[model samples]
Target: MVLYKNEPLTGHPCSRPMARECVATLPASYFSDPKVFNLELQAIWSREWIYACHENRLRMTSPLEMTLATFPISLCLSESGSVAGSLNALTGKPDSRRIHTHVLNGFVFVNFSDAPPPFESTHVGLADEFKSVEHVFTEAEFDFWGHLSLPGAFNWKVFSDNYNECYHCPTSHPQFSKVYKIPSYVVDAREGYFVHSVEERQEGGKAAAASNASVTELLLTESNESFPMEAKRLYDESYSALNQKIKEYAKANPPRARAKAHEGGLFVHVFPNVGINVFGDFVTTLRWNPASHEKTLLQLEVFVRKGVSEAEMLRFSNFLKWVEIEDYVLCEATQKNLALGVYQVGVLHPFRENGLVHSQAQIRKRLVEYVSQERELKEKVGKQRDSSTTLSEESGTLLN
Candidate 1:
């Protein structure tokens, strides 16, 4: 059970468990090695349920399968009435760089996103008039898994790992803490989800402390009587009150962003390589596939872009984009520094980082399974060769 690779890195724990830390200690060469990464790519990704299309992606045709690079995909909904997609890894063919196409029954189908105008499901329609989904071949996703960053992202694991905890808000994310208060750290993953989990830590230990401190403050309130009323006074909050000047000072620094309803719903990573952000209007289905061990391909689709008011769309886009940027910068920073000669792999804040630990545990388990199977195959092959050699020697002896 090699939990933390022997290396060193620098990054504050994104969650509580104050002493817990992470050092991008996973070796850089591992990412450079195709073999190590491919193992993770195949066993963990292919066998898992990646985020395909969000619930609202298709008013017409829903996605059936989504694959990581080229494997059994569920991103394309291939229900009888829905469109089906296929990709074959051809080596010597004319268009051999991984072909992705749609077909119904045995006939090639058209992609609606690429249709010039009047886009409709192609059944018995003319092939000549249809244009290929050009993005399929040249999209940034092709490079998503091989580089440190992309046109639209830096590293995705930040989003996955960050969504797993909210422990840093009180200090690191002053802007964010104002709006949301978190207490619990473990991710109460959605039911039936095998890979990812969403954690909410609202109303934490600080709340209790606040309640206890209020008794003394209340007496001071009656005697000192000359109290200056402020926006978030000691007892201003609904349930608790605070006694210290430090807590008051901390609150004053940044007026917490007023929280609206959970219009921007929670996001969930579908293990291995897909993410889903369930917001107010619609959820987003984001796919990240390994372009290489260190890089990944990302796809973003808004499942419910329709029926949204312009205002809500703008707000959603702004918040989502900003949050992603914040996460990307951190993930990349960790990825880059992880290869340094001095960083050590650290533990997840078990309470807050359960999802991250779960993900790591899952990856480790799969690695063990796949490596074991490979070893078995090599042993079998070696035994066959030895048996064949013995048979040949026996034949020579018999003939002689």
Candidate 2:
């Protein structure tokens, strides 16, 4: 009689120790409490390096005016062609206060703090990683395709919590799951950011071959009559013109080899509100703009290679929109539940939800420090008040 031995199942290395521990998520108050949100605005959003825009958007003639975490900022190009930032006062004048600005691989970042932490030290590994792929960001290699703004009626943290983990991708994003392998997805927490790695689904030894062939066939065989009229009306250029541009671009510049990576796609979420999604043929950035404690505007900026077709771009955009809508529904529903005043805290799955755990830890650390300082100040003020009262009583007794 031959007996077979049972084999042990192994998971991703980063999740092994986390699987052994049960962690608690942040309290519901963190999501719905106005006081906590205000604290965060001072602690996290105002202090950290917030992604502003790509360098391509900055003009020599005029400065780009925008708001970061409700603080007005004007990004201008100096004589040396480097970016400079200025804080805008309530009266629409440029304040004397300095706004720290840093550009990494064509992506611009700004900090509202007076003395922000050193960008290199804060970013550490992330800056080095961006430098490695700096070639792809050059004007000769890729172009800024466009950007999309998606407004949501949920707290910014809710949206961030959703972005930090892929545990819900299988259930929440079916189309996205079909494109990437879910079980192999991993999110690694770095110094000041989180790295998400996922491999594309393969068929017959080729990455994304199935999806690519289907999309190519759809683009070739489909007639213009079936094109969505709404899309045509929304976009300034016609399908034919876009297709011609794609062909011309392809002829001018042949497709080059992409940067090497163990996984097919890599996504980096910097502290606060920046997400960089890096793929072979294209890249997209996700920026979260907090309009209020309960409202967030998500901006997606797409950059594509020289030869990517219009149909391919449209398909990718539609897929992203579908995923965004699904996440928006989830975040808004979660926010409503949080505001119900019933669920105070929840447990997290150590193995599948470690990314969320890391994000909450970062937030909790900042809020905890703020709370500590606030208590200390209150105690000091109370002591001073009591001393003054005692002194007044003694003075009255002496006068009597």
Candidate 3:
């Protein structure tokens, strides 16, 4: 499928599905095209929320805040409740909109939102720190030889598009697929999702309160209350606590694990940058290095309870590392393939690819709104969540 930015499906700067038939049928050569890669860059990753880092990166008061492939975007964690991230102003494109936040990712970057600094600065020379860090743009750090490309190759979306579904899981990732089911066109995701929620954390207070009686946890739909509370409130009651309820239900009615191995934790990929995957007892971060168009790197960090044994934690850590190796290998291969051709277009799966589809839709809509002459897409892009899965609901409580 040769994809052009201003073509019919894209309708000048974007295109969409039903045109997706070519996605599966197109050979590897199609996706390898440089022109197609460029089009994908313009349409996808540019404006979408690409997860760069989590709160942990900026921990130390005078620590090096690195952006994978790019140079370090010096982070100053001062005693005062202000975080000043310094970049190499010379290389940074002044006009570029520093990705203050990946609006689509939904979690407002602490930089933009009201997430105040937990600690304070006990130092001086704030301007000097900004002077030292080399920034391509405030969004991306400068790296003479790193992964972040000003127009990162093919855009990280290619990796994300690949991750959203398991259509290729039966073939590509056999090990993990053996333990948990992957949703394809024919199968429903209720089971895969069911397995995790069953094991996930119960809220702060209630669990096993009533083994069999009726309980209902209603999440009142409210917006922008604070971090953690999220959009819905899961006030557990007599009917069911949807988050932990999935676990109790799954256990009583165990969803068949493709195999007996449920070693890993939940990994609900939040597009553009952040992905949360569970491995045993830890939640891992899958971060990408955006140096340039030719290369990108991804890193994983796992967090677990304070008192857990290291050996126990390593069990899932090793497993996730192996799984990540699979993804990284694929991403590298895809990059190689994309670097070769000029017109390959990938299609989004209507089922397993809610994130990909939502991302593309938002991207197309945004491109039409921001770059189009006709101003055909002026509609605002509210935070997009794949309502099909219980992630938003789960994360709403957990993050809060």
Candidate 4:
């Protein structure tokens, strides 16, 4: 439920002092109010690291179009490999702001704030961590496929909530639950990013293979070979080449970071709106691009180690598409309810919904700071007005 008007936000849900209490979800207005959404765009989204396009999208002669809080931006590379950004809204005008850029493992991340926290400090160890698992996506071993963009009728946070935790997966996504061992799921929450992972059930690979075969057979039957096979075949060949390269590298080297023998999957959620899912066979990305208070664009990208079969590739794509559909349906319904004003707020399950608590708390915290800044600005203006009035009065007296 929403907090009482007189109640103080003196404690955080993550803190021991407030851990036992029925912590309230963020207010309905945070997800439903246009004014609140605009403030979030200015405060949170503008300052956080946003997943821009992959590095391969840019070229020395061409620029990749981007947006920050709906303001158009562009990123281009020069012949010497230097990257530059053009903020269209401030283009050709006297400006002190420059977009910040960080390229990690070929994924381009941008921040719009004049001074975002230093990339290395805010994202400490992540670059090295991802690099440790670079076999799956190192430029020499993997190639970028195409991307999928789907529009949904819901606040971006709705889908984010769905993705953050999988307590609902067993009931909502049976197939996904079958492959992902929900009980072994662990979360490592950090200052700027969160890593939530699940051990892959031993039986999952076989089950997933069966599912893929069925999907592929059905698709082939339905299309009667009309499905675009040429492009898929090309991808398969590229994957095969990648597989050989991986084998050679593995023979020459061992895993840099050794862990107990476990076939687990890992996913990292970067603050604000990007998720990276690393599975056994492929790496997938989900980016939530805010369209409005009630709309978000879901961008999905799948990358596989170079040597995957055509049927398997198709299967993975189909599976992801199905997953996206399921998520969007629930997110849209949740958004409708959130907008109905029928519920003010609800309580979050301390252990299961900790991600929601942290994320919403971050949102509320930034908003409160913005409000404080606004109040201070107003007070300064008021003082200036009084000071000017006093100066004019003294001048009149002296003249008289």
lDDT string for model 3 (1-400, tens) is 2232222321212122222332232334323433333433433344343444443434423544555334335444446623445433436567312223321111122122133222112112222222332121121211111111112234455665566555666666665565554542221122111111222223411232212333332223333422133212221121122234333333444323222222333444443455544443244555654445455555544444333332333333334434554565566666766666643665555435534444454434443443342122322444444532242332222123
| Candidate 2 pairs with clashing backbones | none
TM-score of each: 0.52, 0.76, 0.49, 0.76
Q: All candidates' lDDT scores?
A: 0.39, 0.68, 0.37, 0.64
Best by lDDT: 2
Better of 3 and 4 by TM-score: 4
Expressed as tens digits, the lDDT of each residue in 1-400 for candidate 4 is 2232232223322121113445788777678877667777766788777887666657423577755457688888778866667666566777534588888777778888888888778776567657756654465544455565666789888888788777777777766787778877655555666677677677775556534253432232234433235423433343344344434543444333223222234578877888987765667778998988898888766665555555555566656644555576678778989988998988886556656766777777876776566556657767554554432332332122
Better of 1 and 2 by TM-score: 2
Which candidate model has the greater lDDT, 1 or 4? 4
On a 0 to 100 scale, what is the lDDT of residue 356 in model 3? 46
Error of 4 at 336 (Å): 1.0
Candidate 4: stretches off by over 4 Å: 1-21, 59-61, 90-97, 207-265, 383-400
lDDT (tens digit, per residue) of candidate 1 on 1-400: 3234232211312221222344222234343445555555545544443333432233234444444444534334444434344333445544312223443211222221222222122112222211222211212111111101133222344444555566654544543454455453235332212222224335532233222122221232234433333211322231122113223433443223323332334444545555544443344555665555556555555433222332333333334433444444455555666545355545555445545655555555666675666546657767654554432332332122
Listing every candidate in turn, what is its Cα RMSD in Å to the true structure after a full C-alpha superposition?
18.9, 9.9, 20.3, 10.2
Shift in Å, residue 212, candidate 3 = 33
Please rank every candidate by TM-score, starting with the best.
2, 4, 1, 3
Residue 148 lDDT (model 1): 17
